[model samples]
Every structure is written in C-alpha cells, then in structure tokens.
Target chain A: MCNERQEQDPGKFRDQIRQGKWQKSTSGACPGYVQANLVILPREFALDFTIFCLRNPQPCPIIEILDPGNPIVQEAAPDADIRTDIPKYCIFKDSKLVEERTEITNLWRDDLVTYLIGCSYTFEEALVRGGVPVKNYLQQKDPGVYISSVMCRSAGVFWGPMVVTMRPIPGHLVARTVQITSRFPKAHGAPVHIGNGEPIGITHLEKVDFGEPPVIDRGDVPVFWGCGVTPQLAAMKSKVPFMITHKPCHMFITDIKIEEMAIS
Target chain B: MCNERQEQDPGKFRDQIRQGKWQKSTSGACPGYVQANLVILPREFALDFTIFCLRNPQPCPIIEILDPGNPIVQEAAPDADIRTDIPKYCIFKDSKLVEERTEITNLWRDDLVTYLIGCSYTFEEALVRGGVPVKNYLQQKDPGVYISSVMCRSAGVFWGPMVVTMRPIPGHLVARTVQITSRFPKAHGAPVHIGNGEPIGITHLEKVDFGEPPVIDRGDVPVFWGCGVTPQLAAMKSKVPFMITHKPCHMFITDIKIEEMAIS
Candidate 1:
C-alpha cells in the first residue's frame, strides 16, 4: 500500500490513510505537496481564534479556513474530507487530551470550524532543496519543538506564549536557509530567532516542550521558526471547551505544491 | 488645524480628524505610515467575512481586526478609536449608501466587528520611494478602480467579483514595480494582472466602475492590483443588513511603518 507510485500522488496517499491502511508519520510522503497543521474548533471560538492567527501571522499563517460545519476543504484540496483524511487526530476537552482517533466521523459536528495552518515541514522541504541539511528530515524524526517566552498578541479569548521549532543549521548555510524559507511565508517563513534562543525564553537547549531532542553539530547554529502548534498551546492555555488537532508530524496532505505557496 | 507638524504624527492627525477639523483625503498623508480600508460588520457575518479575507488576502489583507464591539484598536494603534479616527466614513444599509458621516460613534454597536484592511496607498509609498512614478500620487487624484470579471473564492454569505485598481506604468519599469510592491504583502502586494486588462474582463480601459478616470501615457502598460474596496463591493452585492466603510480615498492611518510590512 505504501509503494513509491502511490506515495507520489497526494490524492492516492490520502486514500490509503482514509481507508486506515497507512498510519505512519506523513513526513516524506507526497514529497512536493503541501502538508497542513489542523485545528478544529467550535463556531463560538472561531472568530477570536481567526483574529489571533491574523494578528500573529508568522506563527499561525492560515492556509485554509473551512466554513463552520463543513468538513470538505474547498481551496487547498477541493474534495478532501478533513474529518477522515489525516492518519491521526487528538481530541481535547477543556485543554486536556481525552482521546486519540483514527477518524473523527462520529465526533464531527455541524458547528465545527476547521483551520489548515501553514506547517514548517513545507519550508523544511525548501530548505533541503536549497542544499541546507535538515537533520530531522534525514533522521526521519520530529524536529525539536519548544515554548518560547514570546507572548503572542491576544485576540479575545486566545492568548498565550508562542511555540517554536528549533533546527541546527550549519553556520555557513544560515543565510541561504533564511533566504529559502522566507519565500514561503504561508509556511512558517524565515526563522523568528537565529543565533541565540535564550533571549526568546528557551533556557536549556536540551529541554523540549514537544518532539525529539535536536542533533546539533559542533559548528551548527540554532535557528528557530514560528510553529503551527502555537494555536494548540493557546487553546490549551485558554482552556477551550473542546478542540481537535492532528497528531504531531501526521499532517494533513494538501493538493497544493510548495511552489504555489512561495512568494517569489 | 491641518499643519505639517500635526500631519507627521498619526496620533495628532487622528485627533484633528476626530475633532472634525480635517475632512480631506488621506492620500499622501503620514507619508511612511500604514493606511487601512475600513469594514464594519455585525457579529452574524464576522466569521464568514474573516474567512473571505483570509482566502482572498491579496485583495483584502487584514491589518487589524478589532474585538467585537471594541472600537479602540490595540495593535495597529493602541488607543485610536475606529469609530472616529478616519477622516470620512460611509454608512451602508441593505447594501445601499445611506449616509456619509464624519464619525460613526452614534451608530456603534456591541455586536459590530471592525476590520482594518490593508490599503494600496501603503505600497504606493514604496513605489514612489523606489523611483516608480505613481501618477495618482503626483496628480493628487484617485487611481482608476474597476470591477474585474474574475470572481473571488466565496465564503458563506460573501461572494463577488474582485475589484481592481489600475495604474499605468512605463513598460521599462514594470519589472521594478512588481518587485517593489511585492515587498508589502499586507498592502495587497504585487500585481494580479499586467500588460493587458482585456484578458481580465476589462472591455474598455477608460470605463471604470469607480474612482477617477486614468491618465494613460504612451509606452505605458496597464497594471492591475487587488483593491481593498473588494470587501465593500462584496458586502453590497450580498446586500448585508448593515456595514460601514471609509469613503473612497479616505483611510484609517496606523502607526506601523511601511518597512515593517515588507517581507524581505
């Protein structure tokens, strides 16, 4: 089911996931296609959350926002059923994770509003293409994720510190990495902090709020970017009554190519 | 009350407008600061309208979306009142222009949501600075605005053809113009159509749906950009129950500088 031919097409790959035949991380599948971080919230919290993303665009660049109660994505993927397309999903009640599901067909509601946010994985592809070595991509492991001290602009009920992903880029290739990633603003776009993470509130390089620990080379510089997981952290801090999100690294693949999202 | 001293400071300039001492266009004022298009809607339509802007960011880039019923903008300008900050405003009822007013304080409602959309005026500043001739800026006339045949991605109750502002640029400067404007994504960055307008449904270049007739010169190319007036046109087409917008050429100025909005 995970043959090279099937993995090259987003539609076919999505089919395998929808049928519960594939459940691995979506990192290398559908190589050139876009992957999105999912956030499903009730209509009541939709407005504030949308404004929060708009205000803090770097960390939460919105890719596609579905109309309330509509699970069929229109723009990113014309007919993709968001409720069952992703390989995995986490259900949160009052900011606490209560369950994990392969599909949310039964949990879906008419009032749920889904947001497909730009994920760093999209830009990481560009980084790799630009000759910047992405250790996590090479190792096939999740990037180191952390909670930065940077407080995002609060929009109504949504307010919390920003969450970021850290990558160790070779010192000489740092400039090239920034240039390449800056092209995809819809993706996390350029690094938020380049050299030092301490100023942004990352105290210990070894500590990570999420994902695996970093594999840093001796001459590598720490590069930090706004993460899509920010909204989840904010929702948790706000203690949202109920929300659904994709499991980390198990992003929902979209029909859009990386080039379609690049600014230049 | 309009003086060089007051014009330089957005706060002072807003005060003069709030006091009804200034009643002219906002073009060329606050030279480097950002200016915004205003859109006020009821909470019933807030979610859908926001989604519409998110989907069509090139035309309706959102700079600031005030909290429902909260007239004071927080990020754009800390204490500026959305109700009275702009020089002029138009009140719309059932999609028809009901009244032109100096302020909407009398009509403020708790259920009302105010959206500060990015204005092309902000990018025009970059063009002029980059040596690109902005005829409208030099002649003190509004740019040619027209309704294109291209329809926007619909979001719930809002859907309409994209409205564009046409500018005549010398053929040689076309590439540079695109580069300069592309920097300010928040300000409807880059041209949607360049060279010929006929392809985008402009049958006659002189026939504009709104604003002043264009001043086209020989060896000039017609460049079209996504205009911020798009949302107002959509609101009217949808015949929303109530809405408020700044009068054409009048805009809400923010403290953010043009460089702050530039992507690179």
Candidate 2:
C-alpha cells in the first residue's frame, strides 16, 4: 500500500481513499496525529444537534464543524475532503443504517453540514505512554463499546442514552490510569466509572453493543470513558433522514498535537 | 430596601423575591453563588437560537437550557420559578422592545423555553479577590460593554457581531489577570484581547455604547472578554417575533459556585 511510505500524510491518505487505493480502517495509519468521527446532517437539524453536543461537552467534544453547504473540514484538515478522506462512510436515512460506502462523493450535497467529533485515540496513546498497558492496543483488538442507561442532557431534537467504551485495567494501576487520562480533555477526559459497571447501568461487560468484548480477570476493573458514539446514538434516536458518519475505525486524521489539550 | 438585612441569609433573600417584595440586582446579593443571564423564547425559535449559542461559546456560554416549554431551571436551581424569581425582565414582540416588567408571570406561555447563560458576575468576583479589580465594580458602576467588530460563530437564525465587556488593567498584570479568570470557565473564561481597542473596532472608550466608560489609569492595559451581551445582541439582531431577557443586572442567581465548575 502507498500508506507504507513514511511520506504519507493526510493529503496522501485522502488521495489513497479517493483512488480506491486504501479501503482499510484508519487506526495506526498516522501515528501522533488526531482522528475524528464524522456526523453530517441537513442544515435544519445541524443547529439543534450541535447545541446538544456543546451543552453536554464531556461526551460530544467538538473537533471542527464544516460550514453549511461545505463538505471540506476546513479547520480540522484544510487539504482533505470530507467526502473522500475516510476509508469508509456510513449513510443513514431516517436514523436507520442504510448503506456503507467506500466513498460518499456521490451523496455529498450543498445543504449538508458536517461535524468532526474528537475520538478516543489520543487518550489511548496517553494511557499506554504512562506505563499502563491497554489490552485493546496490545492485542490489536477493538475496545468494548456498550450502550449505557445514562441518559444524555437533551437539547431540541437530540436525546438518547450515553454510549461508552470500556477498557479493563488492573486495580493497582487504575489510579495512575485516571490521572494520566485526565490530562487530555478533548479525548473523553477521564473514566466515568473505574471499577463498578453496574452503577453506570452496564449489566454485563462481556456483551457489548460494539467492538470486541473485553477480558476481565480477577483484580482488573472495567474503566469506561464517554465515547464518540454518543452523537451517533442521538442521531439514530432522532431518526433524522439522510445522516452520514465515519464507518468503524475509518476516522478523519488531523494535524493537531494531542498534548496541546493537556491543561489543568 | 429589604436587601440590606436580607443579605444576612439565603432564607430571607428567597422569601422576599418569592413574595415580590424585592426587585433588585442579584450581583452582590448572592456572594459566592453563580448568577445567570437569562433568555426566554417560544418553542418555535428555541432550536435555532439554542444552536446559535452553541456555535458561539465566547459570547453565549450557556450554563443550562431547560427543555421545551419547561420554565423551571432544574439543573441550576430546581423549583426556581424563572418567570418571577428574576428581579426584572424585558419582553420583545416581533423584534421590538415592548415591556420591561418586574415579573414575567403574566407573559409566561406553555411554549416558552429558557436558556441560562453564564454571567460575568462570578468571574468578576474572582478577579477582585485575586487583586485584579474590574474597574466598573470599584467605581460602583456596571461593566464597559461595546459592540465590537468581532463576529460570533453563527448558528441558524442567530448571526451577528460579538459584544465584549472591557476591563482595563496594568500592562504587567495582564498575564496574571488571564490566569485568574481562566479558572471560571462557566463564567465566560479568559480575555479575548489584551491590547489596543482600535483593532477590535472600538473607536472611543469615552463615548461608551453600553455600560460605564473604563477608567484607564497610567500604565494600565485594556483587556476584553467575550461578553454575555454578545448573545443578547445576536438574539436581538435576529428580531425573533417573541423573546425575553433579564433587564441588565437583575439576573437569575443560583446556588452553583464558580469554583465548583473545575471538574477536572
């Protein structure tokens, strides 16, 4: 793949996606860079949904919003096109998953507004660098994602349960784990619940809604962070006609340093 | 008149306001507690206006937004009747200022939605305690508010220039001033500009547009923060057929503390 070259950048990665040269997930493709979850809606629904994100910040941390009728994520990655940058895209109509496309270039429209939400990639890097092992990265597997019973603060048409990603951490390293993750505010900040899954309305860790199920040993605790899937869940609940999102790990990569978000 | 003795306890303060015996500014009344700038609009305009506030953080940092047709501020202060608790309110009809009433109980409609915006009162108190006194407070006056060249990040039905409140400080204390104010993120955190006023399009400090003219001492610097007034101006610019805001200093005071906002 052309992505095997060191010179591969967002522009190159985007071009690869456009040319059908890359049809794989975007994780680990560009190290030390930022990735975002996409949410595109009609101009009418965009305002209320964006407000819902801003109101409940820990869950829906913004990356950059595209101007109405503009598909380019001008601020996140000016050189890249939102329609073709990602390896895959999900198209939703009336909040139901309609189709998964390799390229959304055909569906792009002037009335559509795009939103880039911060992904958990930055904090996962921070957790690993702090001498704590993330089994998801170590085993090259997806972290467990679950739909929790915690209802999000609603605004206008957007309202739904909070979706969280869980990572099993050894009890001894859990304190240090939260302290490190706490530094990156844009990347879901810190764990909402450290040891207790029942309190946050997660009945069983083994049966998650998305990604692979986590392996919990004797002394390990399941740590949950607010996930980017939150906005998707809300969008789904609203059943807004004609919505689009980045499929699975096919995230849009940005040039911002993750450490720039580490402020007290 | 009752405010002098009412300052001794929260019981008397709430009692008087509830009884309609008192209608005064809530600034110094609720010392450590957070105060909010209120904007009440009908259901028809709620979505668009809410989105506008979300897109523009500096001018319209929202503390809480009630659900459609919900008059009570359940988050900020539960059981608080917003229609009458506030000392004063301005009613706008079809984009024209109509009435400045003490209590909006008569105007309350089933379709009204309320937005509690973060007031500068919280941060200004912190600034005073930190030895960086806001000039207007010392002179026993209101803040120096101006309609600036800076435009708000627009949302549907809400698009206008940002209005800023200026606080003049000594050139050397500028950095310390920012550090002090940054802590209160809920209350319009940090200054937007620290230098010349001309760049932000403020032609004359003497001929002030909104509040008191800033008293610029020798060697002092003029610093500007995104004022809550910006959202008000933007809302006014939209000329929504129906709307309401607390008149000037007569704000909605709550039990929330500014320091309590530092969740991280």
Number of the top TM-score candidate: 1
Per-residue lDDT tens digits for candidate 2, residues A130-207, read 888998876767799998888998877899988999999998999998888877656777787777789888988999
In the order shown, what is each candidate's alpha-carbon RMSD?
1.7, 3.6
TM-score (C-alpha) between model 2 and the true structure: 0.85
Q: What is the TM-score of chain A alone in each candidate?
A: 0.97, 0.94
TM-score of the second chain, each candidate in turn, equals: 0.97, 0.94
Candidate 2's DockQ is 0.28
| A1-264: candidate 1 lDDT, tens digit per residue | 124655678898889889997787888888888999999999999999999998888899999999999999998988999989999999999999999999999999999999999998898888898899999887777899999999999988999999999999999999999899989988988899998898999978779999999999999999999999998899888889999999988899999999988998
lDDT of model 1 at position B176: 99
Residue pairs in collision within model 2: A69-A110, B94-B241, B169-B221
- lDDT value, residue B239 of candidate 1: 76
> How well is each residue in B68-104 modelled by candidate 1, as lDDT tens digits?
9999999898999999999999999999999999999
State the lDDT at A3 in candidate 1: 47
